[model samples]
Target: MIKKITIFLLLVALAAAAGYGYVTKQVEQYIAQPLNIEQEQIFTLKSGTGFNRVLSQLTEKGIIVGSDFSKLVRRFHPELTQLKAGTYLLEPNTTLAQTLELLKSGKEHQFAITFVEGSTFKEWRQALETAEYLEHEMSGLSEAEIAQKLGLEHDKLEGLMLAETYHYTFGTSDLDILKRASSKLQAILDEQWQQRQEDLPLKTPYEALILASIIEKETAVEEERERVASVFVNRLNKRMRLQTDPTVIYGMGDKYDGNIRKKDLRTPTPYNTYTIFGLPPTPIAMPGEASIAAALNPEASNYLYFVASGKGGHVFSKSLAEHNRAVRAYLKQLRSNQ
Candidate 1:
């Protein structure tokens, strides 16, 4: 009976050893074997999102072996608990060790989005919506709400967000993105303001931004920016109204269709430069570096009027007589074409 009891104890010990060995082998295999997931698969892990979801997603995509190994590794290294959200490039042949290292390192994917020089807030909203990183609809968020989210002051986020190609992870928040863009803009503007030429008409940096917005809308030609800026400078110096078409468009607000009708110009609003204007209350569009510079250093010219010459550029005039003649010439040309 004693011998039988000894044999049973030995059998139980052997069974226990076998189970331990099997677990060890499985773990080793998991570490050495490469994950056979397809290439070109993108995984987006959002901020504050848990590891369990990542594991489940990996399992679903067949990127990892099983939940057991994933759970074990996660428990072992609880410090790697948080993952920064981004678009990750996935590979099928990634080893378990390599994957774990990647998770621990928190390497975020980098991509770029450019806000053009003259883009409006509405245009910016559309651009953000189309970006891969920004998931939230910009349409729902008010400018003030967006500014608050981005830690900006109330009522003016329109020109605050700079025009530049910014790098961010796919999961970057619109708020954070806007903040970075604004910071870059502020830096650029500060530098430009410090180096600005003396005796210019602009009162402050904000005023410079306002005038820059005007210059940006006046023409698309790079060489013409400084020249157009001079026209506005002359008007401001003489206390004459700017009478810019874009200002009227701003005043019209929703009423402005694609075309600026004759009545729209005649209609009165604070932004209608044809009636009342020193500078518009705010920027009409985000101006780029060149426009800002033009505002700071306007080209020397006596010209106060510019009418489109139908050549995708304008003909400048120093007096009302020259302006009327140019206008007549343009009008005649338009009529002839029609």
Candidate 2:
């Protein structure tokens, strides 16, 4: 009877060990199972969401098969129990273990919005309005109202924000992006202004920003920014009219029909550099850091004029006669192309 009882106990122990091994193998297979997706999928985990809810969501979306044994995965791998909330990208052929690892790592997917250099405030507004997954708080607000909300001292929003690609998580507000851009622009302007070259005609950092906006509009070539800045600086020193077409266009506002006639240049609006004699009352467009730097420290040159070369960039000149010659050449090139 004692031997029989001992054998019964030993058989029960072996059965228990076999059950444990079977459960472990099942969990391993569960972890190795690929997600039920053929393409990339965006998953959003809201704040205060629990691990069980995440699993339920995956199960509901048919991304994974439901199983009571799958929950035991967390018991084995304790790190999988802590799921961070944010937007995540689950790629095709990603295993269950890989997906859980990504969720636990808290690396949320990022979306990018770019505010292009030389774009006007109106264009920026349109861009913000159209950005995907971004919350639009500034939609119905006036420019002045938006400025006030951003804690700006003045209503002039032009050139206040920096031009660059800003990355954000899902549901980020347009105002939040604007605040970041404005803060970054202010910080960079302050630092650059402090290190500016001596004898610059710019009386304040705002003036430099205004000039930078004009320079940004004048040229798209990276290397030509300093030279373009030099032309404007020289014009400022000589008390000559800037006569830039972009300023005239800005002054025209919605009235500008893509063509600048003699009347538009002769128009006496505040932003029309042909008539204003000094810097515009406000910046014409957003300027990048390089443009701001070029405005503060222009290339040492006597150039006071520049015109489109009709091929790509602009041709710089020291005198009006030289500029007229360049303009004639540009027209000739245009005619030849036609």
Candidate 3:
């Protein structure tokens, strides 16, 4: 009878050992093997999100091999507790170990927003408002208040922010975005101002900024920017009216109907370059660093006029007669298209 009891005890101990080994092997496998996922996945771990919640998320993705054992395994291993919050770009079919390693690193999830050049402050605000994962706080504040909140020197938000793709973590505020853009703009503006050409009509960096905004609206072609700047500078030097239509549209403000007319040019407003002598009262849009550089260092040219070439560019001319010919050609092209 004693021998029978000993045999039964040995059998129970063996079964327990086998179960332990199997669980250990599965835990090791869960920690090592990559899942059968395809494509990069975007996983968001919100602030204060629990590690168990993270485990469940992995289970949902079929990444956890032994889901029941994982809870026990993690409970025994406390080092997997800490987690960071943001939008993580996860590689597909990544190992459970690799994913956890990334989450713990606190640098995996970063998002970006690209502020386009020639975008107005209103448009910039709208973009910030629409961006996912960004906390919107600027929507309620007035533009002037926003400028103040950002600690900017400008009275208004227009032309103060830089145009660039800004990278930030999730839950970042729109104000933070504005602050980064404004700071970048100021830094670039300072550097460009220091490197400006001699005898340029622009008295201050702000004046050059105003001109840069106008140049940004003029053309998108990289090579044409300096020539476009030259035409404006030449016109400014000769006391000729800057008949640029962008300024006229800016002057029209909300009244603009997406079409410029002969009557709009005749009407006088603070932003009307055709009516106003020099630079506009304020920048009409965000000017990139290149546009700012072009405004400060325009090429030496006799160009006094420019008209649309009807080929996604402008035809420049030195004299009024040549300018008139280009204008007539533009009108003829328009009439033909009609």
On lDDT, the leading prediction is: 2
Estimate candidate 1's alpha-carbon lDDT, on a 0 to 1 scale: 0.79
Tens-digit lDDT string for candidate 2 (6-40):
99999999999999899989988887889999998
Residue pairs with backbone overlap in model 3:
none
Best-matching candidate per TM-score: 2
Per-candidate TM-score against the hidden true structure? 0.73, 0.93, 0.88
lDDT of 3 at 221: 94
How do the candidates rank by lDDT, highest first?
2, 3, 1
Off by over 4 Å in 2: none
lDDT of 1 by residue, 1-338 (tens): 99999999999999999987776666667656687666756677666667777767777877776746556555455655556565676667777566655665767567678888888877777778788756564558778777777776647666676787888876566667777888887887888898887888788888888888888888999999989999999999899999999888878878888899888888899778888869878888888888888888889999899988887999999999999999999999899889
What is the alpha-carbon lDDT for the whole of candidate 2? 0.92
Q: Model 3 over residues 238-280: C-alpha lDDT tens digits?
A: 8888889999998898999999988899999999988889888
- Candidates, ranked, TM-score: 2, 3, 1
Say which prediction, candidate 1 or candidate 2, comes out ahead on lDDT.
Answer: 2
